[model samples]
Target: MSTTERPRILVVGGGYVGLYAAKRIMKKMRYGEATVTVVDPRSYMTYQPFLPEVAAGSISPRHVVVPLRRVLPKAEVLTGRVTTIDQDRKVAVVTPLVGEAYELPFDYLVIALGAVSRTFPIPGLAEQGIGMKGVEEGIGLRNHVLEQLDKAESTTDENVRRKALTFVFVGGGFAGAETIGEVEDMARDAAKYYSTIKREDMRFILVDAADKILPEVGPKLGTWGKEHLESRGIEIYLNTSMDSCVDGHVVLKNGLEVDSNTIVWTAGVKPNPALARYGLPLGPRGHVDTAPTLQVQGTDYIWAAGDNAQVPDVASRKAGVENAWCPPNAQHALRQAKVLGDNVVSGMRGFPQKEYEHSNKGAVAGLGLHKGVAMIVMGKMKIKLKGRLAWYMHRGYHGMAMPTWNRKIRVFADWTLGMFLKREVVALGALETPREEFYEAAKPAPAPAAAAAPAQKAKAS
Candidate 1:
C-alpha cells in the first residue's frame, strides 16, 4: 500500500473483461514490480451466456459466476463502486461496500465497467419491467415464472388466473429469446404439478422491433428460429414494439393489448454512463473510444475493453462494408482482455504492443430442452444445425467455454442429472424477502368481533 513502492494498476468493474484483464496483468507482471487492484460492486464475474439455462433450471446459479477473489488470487480485489476518477491526478474515488468513500491512487487505470440495460421513457416500464442483466435478476425471473403458476392454480377467478399465466417478453435478441424460451419450457413442465393450471392455459408473447429474432445466426437460421418458436405456441411479434406496459397492462404498437403479471425487458443495452463523468474520449454510442491496441484514446496510462469500450474490429474488410469495430460479445471480450492485459504489461516494460484481430466464429442459440440452432462459419463454408444436435452443440460449446474447471464440471453435472430427473417446478418467490411471511405470521391477531360488540352493547345499555 505504499505510495513510493510499486506501480499500481486499478481496474474498474469485475465483469468478463475486468476479471480476465486483471488476471493476465497479475500473471504477466514480474515478481513485486507492479500491483494490480480490481474494484467492482460484485465480488464475482457472471458468465452471462449461461444465464438463460440458469433461469430455465438447466444449470445452478452458483456455477455460472466466477468469484473474482478466487480467480485472481495474486491481485487485490476491492468490492466497491468507482464514483469518479480524476484522470489528471491518476486517482479514482471508490465507495466500498461497508465503509466511507476513499481515494484510490493508481499508476494506470482500466475502465471495464460494462453496459446496463437500455431503457426509454416508456410509461410504467420502470415499475413493471424485469431486467435480465445479473445473476439475481435471472433467479428472480425463474421464481417469478413459477410463482405465476402457483397463483393460477390457487385462484378461482378466471381473470386473475389468465393474467397470471400471460407472460410477455420485450426483446428478440439472445437474452430475450433465450429467457422466454427457457421460462416457457420450465412453465410447461411445471404444469404437471398443478391441478388447475395447464400448459394450454398459458400465453407466451415475444415482442421485438426488429424484423427477425436471433440475427446473429444469419437470416436463414433467424427465420428458422422464428418458425421453431411459433410452432411451439409462442406468439412471435416481429416488426413491432411495445407501446406501454404500465400497471401490468401491455399495449403493443400493432394495436394489440394484454394484461399480464410478468413483463421481462431485454430490448438492448447501452454502455454505462459512468464513463462520461471521467472525461474520457467517447464514441457516438457513449462507449469509451479506444485504439485497436485497447488503450484508451489519448492516454497511455488508461485502458478499456468489453461493452464499455469502442475498439476497432480489425478483421472485417470489404470496401463498402463497415469494418474496424468489433461487436460486444463474450468472444471478443475474452480475446480483447488477453491483448489488453498483455498490452498493459508491454507498456509497463516499454515493449511493443499488439493489435487485436479475430473473425466471428458464428453463433448458436438454444430455444428449449433438446431444441436449438447453430451456424458455425468455417472459412468459406457455413454449417447450420438444429434440433437435438444443435442443442447438444450449444450446451457443449458453453460448457467448455465456462470459466473454470470446477464450474464447467458442475454445469455438466446439472445437465447429466436433468436427463433422468424432472425439472424442479417449485417457485421460491419469497427468496428475495422470506422474512416478510415470518413477520406477518408473528403479528398479533385482531380481537374477536363478538367480544368488541358485546362490550359496546353493555356500555350503551
Candidate 2:
C-alpha cells in the first residue's frame, strides 16, 4: 500500500475485462513489483449475462455481482471514473464519487471501459425506456413489470388495465428475448394468485429491427425460438422499427400501436463514448484500436480489450476474412483479459508478447424454465439443442462461467433451490422512493373523511 517506486498499473474499469485483467496481473507479478489499481464507478462488478434472471427474480442481485475489493484484495480498487487520460504525462484524471478530482500517475494503462446502452433520438426513449444492462435496471424492470400487474389488478378502467397489462420490448436480441421470456414466465405464475388478471390477459410484445433474432444461434433455431414464443401467446414483430414511444403510446413502423406502461429497450450497445476523451486511437465505432497481441496499437505500455477495444479476431483472419474483429461478448472479453494481462506482464519484463486467438465455443440462451436454445461448436461438428436440454445447457454454461468459485457456487445453489421452490414474486416498487409513504403521512391533509361529511351536511341543511 506504500506510494513508493513500484510500477503503477492503472486499470480504467473494473468490469469483466478490467477486473479479470487486474486480477491476472496481480497474480503473475511478484509482491511490490507493481502497484495495481482498478478504478470504476461501481464498487461491484455485475455479471451481465445473468441480468435477465435477476429481472425475473431467479437470482438475487447481490449474488450476481462480486464486490471489487473482496475479489481483488491485492489491487487498489477505487470507486470512481477516469474522466480523462493524459498519455503524454502518463497520468489519468480520476473523478471519485465524492471530493475533488485528482490525477493518478500510471506506468502502464489498461483501458477496459466497457460499453453503454446504444440509444437513439426516439422520442420518450430517454424517459420511458427500461434497460437490462445492470442489476439496478434488472431490479427496476422487475418492479416496473410487477407494478403494472398491480395496476391492472386494482384499476377498474379498461384503458388503464390494458395499458398496464401491455408489455412492449423493443429489440429481439439475447437481452430482449430472454427478458420477455423470463418475465412472461414470472407473470404467468403470478397471474394464478390474482383475482381478475389471468395469464392470457397480459399482452407481451417483442419488436426488433433485425430480420432474425439470436443470429448467434443461426437462422433455424432463431425461427424456432420465435415460433415457440409466439405459440406461448407472445407476439413477435420482425424487421420493424419503433417510431416513437411518447407518453407510453408505442407506435411502430408496421402500423401497430399499443399503450404500454412498460417499454424495455434492449436494442443494442455501443462502445463507451468516454474513449473519445482518452486521446487513444479509436475504431470507426468508438472502440480503442488494439493489436492481436491485445496491446493498444502503437503503444507498448498501454493495452485495451473487452467491449471497448476493437481487437482483431484471429479466427476470422484465419478464414481469409478482411477487417475481422473480436466480438464484444463475455466469452471474448474473459479470454482477452487473460491475454492482455499476460502481455502487460511480458512487456514489463521486456519479453515477447503472445497474440490473442480464440474461436467462439458457442452461445446459449434461456427462455424461462425448461425452454431454451443453444449452439455448441466442437471441432467440425455443430451441436444445436432445444427445449429442456438447451435450457439446462444454458444454465450449466453460465453457472460454471459465472466467475470465481464464490459466485459459481452461489449461482448453482440458486438453481438447485429454484427447482424445489417457486420464483419470488414480491415487487418492491417502494425502493425507488422508500420515504414517500412516510412523507405523505407527515403532510397535512386537505380534510378528513369525517370532517368533509359533516361540512357537506351543514351546507346542505
Candidate 3:
C-alpha cells in the first residue's frame, strides 16, 4: 500500500452491528484503500436468539457465538473497551482486558456499542437474580437450574425442597418468555430421570407488569401465547410486578408471596451508556441521535448504528409519522449495519450515501422444543402463526441469519444430533468454580494444634 494514506474506520463493539458493518465495508473497499478496526470487551459476537436453546441444552454454547477474529480476518479486531472519545482530537481511549489503556486515532468512527440488560432497583435483585445476556449467562443458568434440582432432590427439609423447585422469571418479552419455556421443558424432562422429583412438583412462574405478553406479535397471537404457556402448567401472573426478593423471599405487587431459589431477570435492554463519553448528540433515551442516513446528526466524520443509535425509521416517516424510530432488535441492527458500512465507504470515496429505510419484516420466537410463535409481515398481510409450524419457522429464520455458514452447519448438526440423543441434563456446576479444589489444596494446614500444649499440662501436674 502507501506509506500511511489508508483511512482508518474504527468500529466500537464487535457485536451484530459492528461485525456485519466491518465485513460489509471490507467487501466494498478496495485493497489498501481503508483499514477497519473493531474493538469490544468480548472477542466473540453472540447470536442472542439461540440463548434459550443453550440454556435448555438444545444446542451447545460454543455453536451460537462467532469469534470476531476468525470472522473478520481483514479487519483489525482488538479485544478491549472504548472508555472515552475526544471527538475534537479524533482519538478514543481504549481499555484492554488487562494492563494499561491507550488512545487510538481514527479518520471515521462507528459507534455500535450495543445495549445492556435493563434492570430495576428491586431489592435483593443485585445479589440474587440471574440474567441471560450472554453465552456465559446461558450456561450458568443451565448449570444453576440443574444444580437447584440436585439440591431439592438431595435435601430433606420441606422448605428447602420447595424453594429449590420454584423458579420465578420476570418480564415477558422474547427473552423472558423463550427462556422460561425452554428451561421449563428441560427441567420437566430432567425431572423424569429424578426418582424423587416430578414435573408437577416444580413451580414455573412467569410475571409481567403489563396486562399482556408478547406484544410484538399483536394481541391475538399474544393471547394464544399466554394461554399456551398456562396450559403447560406455568403460572402466568399478568399486571404483577415483583416488589422485592429479599433473601429469596419474593413479594409481588399482586399480594402474592413466595420463597424461591431462582429469580431470572429479562425485562428488556437499554442503549450502552458509553455514548455520553464520545461527545455525540444523543436522543431522549440516551441513544446516539442520527439522521435517517445513519450518520451522526451534524457529523460527517462519525456514524452510529445498532441498539445504541436512534436512527429515524424512514419507513415509518414515509407513512406520515415523524417521531418514529427503528426498534432495537437484531432485524434492524443487521440491516442498519450493512447500510452504515456502505455509507462509511461511500463517504470516504466521495460517493452518495444511502438512507436506511426498511419496515419490520416480522418476529419469530421459539417457545420450547416443539412450540413457538411467529409474525410474518408482507405488505397488508400479517400472518401470525403458533405451535410446531412456528417453531420450525423460528429455527429456519435464525439458523440462516447466524453470521457464517460454518456456524449455521454446526447449529443444524447440534439439532440433528439432539434428535437422536437425549439432552445432556447433567449440571456441571463445578465449571463455575473450576479452581475450587485447587484453592482448597493450596490453603495452609492448621498450625499442628499449637504443639498440643504438652509442656504446659506436664508442668501443671
Q: What is the TM-score of each candidate against the true structure?
A: 0.95, 0.95, 0.96
Clash pairs, candidate 3, are none
Model 3 score (lDDT) = 0.92
RMSD of 3: 2.4
Off by over 4 Å in 3: 1-5, 450-461
Worst 10 residues of 1 by lDDT: 315-324
What do the candidate models score in CA lDDT, each in turn? 0.90, 0.91, 0.92
lDDT of 2 at 350: 95
Cα-based lDDT at residue 226, candidate 3: 92
Q: Which ten residues in a row have the lowest lDDT in candidate 2?
A: 1-10
Q: Which residue runs does candidate 2 get wrong by more than 4 Å?
A: 441-461
> Which residue pairs overlap in candidate 1's backbone?
313-324, 313-325
lDDT string for model 2 (288-379, tens) is 99899988889999999999999999998998889999878999989999999999899999999999999889899999888999999997
lDDT of 1 at 285: 93
Any idea what lDDT model 2 has? 0.91
Better of 2 and 3 by lDDT: 3
lDDT of 1 by residue, 1-461 (tens): 23546899999999999998998998888999888899999999999988888899889999999999899888888998999899888889989888799998899889899999999888989999999999999999999999888888888999999899999999999889888889889998998888887888999999999999999888888888889888889999999998888899999999999999999999999999888988899999999999888889899888899999998887774323474588888889999999999999999988987988788898888999999889988987999998889888888888888888988999999999999998987778888998999999999998899888999999999
Tens digit of per-residue lDDT, candidate 3, span 1-461: 11245778999999999999999999999989988899999999999889999999999999999999899988888888999999889988989989899988889999999998888899999999999889999999999999999999999999999999999999998999999999999999899889999999999999999988888878899999999999999999999999999999999999999999899999889998887888899999899999888999999978899899999999988999989999988999999999999999999988888999999899998889989999999997999999999999999999999999989999999999988999899999999899999999999886566675886688899
- Identify the leading candidate in terms of TM-score: 3
